[model samples]
Target: MNQEPTAQEPILRIDGLSKSFGPVRAVDNVSLDIQRNEFFALLGPSGCGKTTLLRMLAGFETPGSGRILLDGTDIAPLSPEKRPLNLMFQSYALFPHMTIRKNLSYGLEMERLAKTEINHRVDEIMAVTDLTPFAERKPEQLSGGQKQRVALARSLIKRPKVLLLDEPLGALDKKLRERMQLELKRLQHEVGITFIIVTHDQEEALVMADRMAILKDGRLLQCGAPEEIYEHPADRFVANFIGVMNFISGVVTPNGSFEADGLSVPMPGAAAGPATLAIRPESIAVSMNGGGIAGSLVDAAYHGLDRVLHVKIAACETPLQVRVPAHTSADLGIGSPIHLGIDPDRCRLFPD
Candidate 1:
C-alpha cells in the first residue's frame, strides 16, 4: 500500500498563484498545500502550466499575482539564490569538464564554505546518492542515470528545505527511466526532504509521488493520492487524462436505470438527468458469450502479462478497451463475438 502524507503543517503553500505572458495566462489562480517530507508531483500535459508552476516555486518565474509561502513566510520576494530551495533541471547541468566530485562540490564552494566542510558535504551526498564509485569521472564518462544522480546529489548536498525536480528522468531510456523512478522515491524517503517534481508522465507521477495535483490549461483540475485520483476522478478531463476510460453517454431514468443506445444499466443514487458513465478497461471483463452487452472484438494487443482487446459495441460510438490475463484467452481474435461484464461499483457517473 502507498503511504499517505500525515496532516502535519504544510511546508509550502501556494495561494491564488497566477502568471501571465501578455495575453497568455500560464498559471491561473492555482493553489496547493504540500506537506513536509512529502513526495508531491505536478502532473499535466504540455501547455498545462505544470512547468510554469514549478518555475514559480523555484523562484525562476515571478507570478503575476500570488503569494508563495515557505514555512509560513512568504518567499515571493526572495531571489532564486536566497530561497532555501534547489531545483534540478531536466538536463543534468553538470559541468562537462568537471569531475563528479567537483560538480557536487561546486555549489558549496560557490558559497565560500571551508574546504573541509565542502569536501565532507560532497562525500556525504555522494555516499547518499551512491555516486562515490564514479566520484572522479567526468560527465561524459557517466551513464544517463549516473549523471542524473550526480545532478540530484549536487542539488541535495545543500540540505535545502525543499527540492524541485523538472522532468528529471526524461533523458533516460525506458528501462533506466523506470528504474530511476523507484530509486528517486527511495532517495526521497531516505532524505526526508519535501520533493516537488513536475512531469507529464502519469505513470511516473503515480509510482513516485505521495500525493499529486493535476493541472490543465493553467488551472488546477484535481489533487489527490494516485489511487484516489485514478479511482475517483472529479470530471471528464481528469478521467481521460489519468488513464484509459470508456465513457458511455446516457440518461438516468426515473427507475434509477441509465439508458443509452439500445442499452440500459442500473445506476443507483444517480440523479435523474443526462450523464456519462466512466469505466476503466481492467474493471470490464470479456468472454466469448454471456448474457451481457454484445460486442465484437475489433483488435487484440498481446502484452506479456495481459491482453487488451478493443470491443466494438453498437451502444457507443467508440470501442471499449477490455484488459484480461493473457493466459485466459489464447483464441480471442479480431471479429470474434464477445460479451462485456462491467462492474457497476467501479463505474463513475458524472453529469453531462
Candidate 2:
C-alpha cells in the first residue's frame, strides 16, 4: 500500500454530473473528487451507470448537465483528443500487425514529436511497464499479460494527467487477474498518475482502490475507502453489494432496540417500524456452548483458508452465512448445534 501521498486538492472533480439517453437516465447527479496520483474505482453492477460516468470523465460521452473540472478548469466541452486524458479499453485494442514498440509509440508518433524524444518516452514507459523485452514482438505473438502491458504502455507514453480504465483485467483468468490488481496499483504509484477504473467486480475495487464510489441504477450510493464502506455501508443495497451480509429482520421499539430472531440489539435513532440488523460473517461470534442465540448448522462451504457455515434459526426465514477459520470448521458437521453471539455495536441497522 506504500505510495506517494495524495494531494489535498482534487486533480479532477465531477460536479452534479448526469447523463441520459432518451428515456433512460444513465448517470444521475453524481459528483466526486479524485486526487492526483491516487487509484480511484467506480464500481457497480451492470446498468448501474458506472461505465457512463467513466465515459463522461474520458470525454467519450457528453454530460447532459453539470461540469467536469480538471485542475479547476472545465473540460466538459473538450473532445477526447483535445483533453489531456487517456482511456485504456478492456480489449487491449492492439493492432495485430504492429510490434510492441510501435504500439507504444503510436500515440507519440501522432503527436509528431522528435524521433529521439518519442523513443525515449517509449523506452521509459516500456521499462516502467516491463514491456521492453517484448518490444519487437507483434501483438498476436504476445500472451494476454504481455499484450495488456503493451496496451498500458501505449497509454502511459502520452503521460496523461488521468488514465481511465474499463475493466482492464476482465479478460484474464482469476489468478492472473488477482495478481494484476496489485500490479496495477504498483504501476499507478510508480507512474504518479491518477487512475480511475470502472468495474463491476467488488473484490477488484476493494483490492486495488485507494477510494471507491459505488453506484446503483444511476445513483451514487457511497464513496469512501474500501474498509470504510465495507464496515459502514450507507444502506442495505450497499451492504449486500459490497460483500456478504447477514440481515436479521426485526422491529424497532420506542426503547431503541431491534428485536428479532431471538435476539435484541440497540438501534439508536431508528423509528418504530420494521428494520434490519446487518452483520458480516466475521463479526458474529460462534460457539458450541454459550448463552447466545441458538441455531443449527445446516450446510457448510469450503474456501481455501475459511469456511462459510450456513446456520438455520427458527425466527429467521433463511439460513445465515457465518464465516470461520478452516481449522475451527473442520470438526463441525451438518445438523450440529451452534450458537451465535453478535455484539450490538458491530451491527448496522437500517430502518425501512
Candidate 3:
C-alpha cells in the first residue's frame, strides 16, 4: 500500500523530532504520523533509539527540539502524568506490596476517584485482561505470563488514547513470549485503541504490528507493513537485520543480471552496477537436472521442519544456505553436487 488514508486527522503527529545528550544524539530528526486505532511498532537493535522515541511519545523523555501533536494540539511541554498516554515498561514494574487488584486501581486512586468508580474500573480491567480470578494474588505468587497480564491490565485500565509498550514480553521465555504476542495483537484489535510498541525482537514486531518503523543509529531506516518490509527491504541493512539472507556480491551484467565469476543469476529489471543480490534461504530451489548455479554441499542438517544445506558455489567466497523439505534429505546429502536457482523476482538488488 502506498500509504494509509491520511486525509483523516492523525491521533499523533511527530515532526522534526530530535534528542541529544551532550554530543551524542539518541533520536535524530524523526517524523511520524500514527493513525487512530493503528497498531504501530518501533523496531531495531538495543541501542537504535526505538525505546527513546517511545519514551518521548509517552512524555517520559523530553525532545530537545520538535513538535508533538496529539489530536491537533501541541503536547511537547506537558508532564507525563498529564498526557493522555500510559507506558508499560519491560520489567512490568508492579508494586510488590500491593495485590493485583490494588495495582490495577493505583492509578485511579491517585486521580482521587470515588471508591465505587475505582472498584468498577478495576473489575472491568480485570475482565478485559482475564485476571479476574487472580485479583487478590500478589506479584510474587504469579507466573511470568500472569505478571505480564497484570502489567498490561494496570496500564490499560485508564483507557488512554495511546498505549506505549517497551519490550513488555522480553521477560518471558520463548514459548510464553510467542503466546503473548498473539494475545497482545488480539487485545489491541479488541480495544480499538492506538497501540505503539517498542521491541528489539524482529519477530515480535512483525507479528504484532500493522506497520513497523526500523531504526538504526538514531535514524529511521525504513517504515512499512510487515510483508512489505520482509519482501522488499529498502537496503542491505534492512534485509540482513529483519531475517536470515544469503548475500551474493556480483557485477551487474549487460542484460541486468548478476554475474559472479562462473555463476550467473538473473536480476529482472535491475540496474547495471556492482551490486549485492539477497535471497532468503527458503526461496532457493534445488534441481537434480544439473541446471542453474553449480555448488558443492558442505554441510546438511535436519531441523525437523526442513533440511538445511550449506552450498559453497564456485568463484564465491561465502557459502549459500539452501532449505529443502525434511523428507528430501534422503535424496540430497553432504558433499553432493547440486544446482541452485531462484526466480528473478525473489532476488533483491542493492547497489554498492
**Model 2: worst 10 consecutive residues (lDDT sum):** 1-10
Tens-digit lDDT string for candidate 1 (199-272): 99998999999999999999999999999999999999999999889999989988888888766779987899
Clashing pairs in 2: none
lDDT score, residue 164, model 2? Answer: 92
Which is the leading candidate under lDDT? 1
List candidate 2 stretches off by more than 4 Å: 1-6
lDDT of 3: 0.89
Error of 2 at 203 (Å): 0.5
lDDT, model 3, position 1:
83
Which of candidates 1 and 2 reaches a greater lDDT? Answer: 1
Count: clashes, candidate 2: 0
Model 1 lDDT vs. the true structure? Answer: 0.91
What Cα-based lDDT does every candidate model obtain? 0.91, 0.90, 0.89
**For every candidate, C-alpha RMSD to the true structure in Å:** 3.4, 3.4, 2.6
The parts of candidate 3 lying over 4 Å away from their true place are 1-7
Worst 10 residues of 3 by lDDT: 1-10
Best by TM-score: 2
Candidate 3 lDDT over residue span 193-305, tens digit each: 89999999998988899999999988899988999999999989999999788898889987977988687777767788898889999999988788888899998888999
Tell me the tens digit of each residue's lDDT in model 2 across 1-352: 7654556779999999999999999999999999888899999999999988988888899999999999889999999888898999889899888888888889998899999999898888888888888989899998998888887888888999999998999999999999999999998998899999999999999999999999998989999999999999999999999989998888999988888858877777778888888999988889766678889999999998999999998668889989989888799979989998888888998887
